[model samples]
Target: MTAARTPLYEEHVRLGAQMTNFGGWVMPLQYSTIREEHHAVREAVGLFDLSHMGELRIGDETLVQRVLSRDVTRLRPGRIQYAVLCNDAGGIIDDVLVYAMPDRGYLLVVNAGNQDGDFDWIRKHAQAADAARNVGREWALIGVQGPRAVDLVQRLTPSDLASVKYYAFVDGTVADVSCVISRTGYTGEDGFELFCGNADAVRLWRALLEEGRSDGIRPAGLGARDTLRLEAGMRLYGNDMDAQTNPLEAGLDWTLNLEKDFIGRDAIMTSRQRGLARQLVGFKMLDRSIPRHGYRIVSDGEGVGTVTSGNVSFTLGYNIGMAYVPPAMSEPGTRLGVDIRGAAAPAEVVPLPFYKRPHPK
Candidate 1:
């Protein structure tokens, strides 16, 4: 299958970015270097083209409440909540952001790769045939992340950004382009994610880059995005968890509201009563090897679990990764080993989110 190009494709080429195929879309891997981009977001700011993410517009409140793990009725308009979509068997289908629009409908921002499958699954369970609409291709998502992100965007808009609390959104204009200015991000930083029309993507992208030049803003890509998210202790869909993985074992129990009746609630309750065999936990390398996905995790010379996500944390100057291990071995400071080419590279289980942004004064 041919990979689709985003509206910023030409701009990425013009900037000489390294392009790679991600989730059926050709996206920038890095503009200059992954380390540089990573540091830019940590210290200053970085812009991203997130057009490949899927957007589903659903008008049926009943369908929304049935599928989402969180109680959507409590999600007020202009606010967003992070939740997961689960199957009847208590396995996660996808992790998504539920945005309650002012118009009383809901917008689900899902992973690019699972967009089609998610649409099919939701539509299959919808009370009305036209309750869900796939609007991903018609929109573009641009993420401006970092310490200076809010200020950089404030210059281009007349909206009161100060009042736009985190996880909240407002319909406004930026660079004279209409947008749904949302205060949310993946990089564990203070930032805003701007949603605009596909035609306005290039313009919005260029305007942000130009305006942020003085603030040490750089166009970041998937490579930097991965490391930043890892340091922030954020989970990637396919890497951290999947259709076969339950949210309970993934340390996402907070996303589930057992009080409300929803899809997979019964199975999830059953799993809770039955007990989990393994759990996901964070670990840092004690030896000099970098952990990679699918690496075997060992304890007492036995293969115990598998590494899900691993990388060299640029900010901390250490190797960090996440893996699923037995409940007994999941605590911080528990010693373990990562099998690296027949060698047991020593590692220690640690609390997640190796890095956290300092609070603003």
Candidate 2:
């Protein structure tokens, strides 16, 4: 199958970025270097093209409530909630963001790779054939992330960003382009995600890069995005969990609301009652070795688990990764070993979020 190109594809090439196929889309892997772009986001600002993400517009409140793990009725207009879609067996279908539109209805922002399957699953369960619409291809998503992101975006909009609290959104204009200005990001930084029409993507992307030049803003890519999210202790869909993995074992129990009836609630309850065989936990390498995904985790000369996400954290200056281990060894400070090649490298479980942005004074 041919990979699709985003509206910013040409711009990425013009900027001499390394391009790679990701989630069926040709995306920038890095503009200059992963480390450089990672630091740019931490210290200054970074622009990202997230057009590959799926957007589903649903008008049926009943359908929304039935499929999502969180209670959507309580999600007020202009607010967003992080939730997961689960199957009957209590396995996660996809982790998604539910945005309650101010005008009416709801928008589900889902991972790019799972968009088609998610749409098919949701439509199969809908009362009416038109209850849900997959508009992922018609829109473009640009993420402006970093410490200076708020100020950089504020200069181009009249939306009074101060009123748009975290986890909230406002329909407004930026750089003369209409957008859904959402105060949410995956980098664990203060930022906004602007969603706009596909035709307006280039204009918005260029405007941000030009205006943010003074602030040391750079166009970040998938490589830097991965390292940034890892340091933030954020979970990647395919890496941390998948269709065969339940949310309970992924440490995402907070996303489940058992009080309200929803899909997979009963199975999830049954799994809880039965007890989880393994739990996901964060760890840091004790030696100079860097952990990688699929590396075997060992304890007492026995292979216990496998690393899900691992990388050298530029912000923390240490090797960090997440893995699923038995409940007994999931605690912080527990000693384990990562199998790097044929040798067991020392590692210790640590609290997640190896790095956190300082609070504004």
Task: For candidate 1, write residues 1-361 as lDDT tens digits.
Answer: 9999998999999999999999999999999999999999999999999999999999999999999999999999999999999999989999999999999999999999999999999999998889999999999999999999999999999999999999999999999999999999999889999999999999999999999999999999999999999998899999999988899999999999999999999999998999999999999999779999999999778999999999999999999999999999999999999999988999999998898899942
Q: Residue-wise lDDT of candidate 2 within 1-361, one digit each (tens)?
A: 9999988899999999999998899999999999999999999999999999999999999999999999999999999999999999989999999999976799999999899999999999999999999999999999999999999999999999999999999999999999999999989788999999999999999999999999999999999999999998899999999988899999999999899988899999999999999889999999989999899999878999989999999988889999999999999999989999989999999988777889842
Sequence-dependent TM-score of model 2: 0.99
The parts of candidate 1 lying over 4 Å away from their true place are none
RMSD of 1: 0.8
Q: Please list the C-alpha lDDT of all candidates, in the order they appear.
A: 0.95, 0.94
Clashes of each: 0, 0
